[model samples]
Target chain A: MNPLSVVVRTICDIFTWFIGIFGIYIIIHGHMTPGGGFQGGAVVATMMAFLLVSHGGKKTLSFAKPGLYTAMETIGLLVFIGAGLFGITTTFFFNFLAGQGGVFGATVPIGPNSGVLNSAGTISIMNMAVGLEVIGGLSLIILYMFKGIRLFDNAAESGETGHDR
Target chain B: MKKRVLFMIAILVVAGTFWGALDNIHPFGDVPVAPMDDYYIENAQQERSVNNVVTAVVFDYRGFDTLGEAAVLFTAVCSVLALFRKGREGQ
Candidate 1:
């Protein structure tokens, strides 16, 4: 029974890692391709849920930090919204600001039709915001779920068995 | 047992085939199917201030979706609260 459980858990881990990678791939290539922030974020969140279920509570969620996740989500959204307001002069949501151009760790040509994946403008910044918000928010949700389940189970065992804390 | 597995596989195959067919059709392509044109990008650009059109669509344009997502978080919190609340009541 133990061995079978281990095998099932291993398979689940592999599937979850695949989900995480696919989610990230969609987010990063959001500019050139279609997949962007919200879709990729949900994917990552589901992957986190998978991880929490496969691994024990301590291993998967002991590090659950609500404050940090909240901060990241708030900051990421602020940045995303700020980008839009800063571009208020030209267009309502023109993303063609400093964040709009750069190559792999290098700046883009600082002109029109610069490099494809350069960190210019609205797309990259927004994707980043989505990434941060989704990863933190989703993980927190799943971690809290596990915490609730564990608490309920423990309480039930204690109450039913007439045990003292 | 074998019949059950085969039946499940048959259903999966039909579903997968339907998905592949839709993939060819490309339902989300830039066009109107029934009444409204593919207002996805237009709608997105109109609402949000974000540069990435998609982000605007999710965060600003469709603020309700974000709210619903927040509700999901709240639901999870409520579940956790239930466990603790019940225990405290007993004690």
Candidate 2:
């Protein structure tokens, strides 16, 4: 696909980092806020789509490696499963770190108040894991779909020339 | 004429079902009594140490479902990759 106009590309360059930052904020604050991993990851994945539209498939694909995303997807799933497994002595998916007074283990007041980022234990860990998984999954889907389109275009061109030969 | 009549009937069935369902709907902002929801609201923060009860429920209490959901997404990504894989050249 061809790149968009210079104006659109310029705007995309200015705003793409903001989109990524916002998505990471949502993922990081999932346990304390409205949005969580799935939602935030989906928001972050839009960066891939946005780049593909503004910069074109060739540049986007070259810049973003499939291997990196594949690794991210695998690692996220492993971490999520590992988090669940760690609490198996009590019960699967237990909040073992909550109230334990450490990273992601701070206790919040029993009633309504401002949220604590250091709270939420395995929930926060799982949120980050799922967020990573979603970012990799959705971006891979978009990239592969674009590649498929290019393959189809090549096949059509080859078929057209075959008729002349 | 027959196809149009069938389409009209189908639309009426869907609309009637929706209209009937609306009558049973509770008033806005008035939630039905649910012991499970009450338990989560009351205890999630204390147990999970998370201010967001919804997140606590999703990522903690009902985490098995989220695991399944993640697996589903992984499978979908795998399938897309397999389908779009480049064919061997000079084969």
TM-score of chain B of 1: 0.46
The regions of model 1 sitting more than 4 angstroms off are A1-4, A98-115, A150-165, B1-91
Clashing pairs for model 2 are none
CAPRI quality level assigned to candidate 2 from its DockQ score: medium
Model 2 interface Cα RMSD in Å: 0.6
TM-score of 1: 0.56
For model 1 chain A, the run of ten residues with the poorest summed lDDT: A104-113
Number of the top DockQ candidate: 2
lDDT of candidate 1 over A39-97, digit per residue (tens): 77778878766665555545565565767876766666666667556667876455444
By TM-score, the best candidate is 2
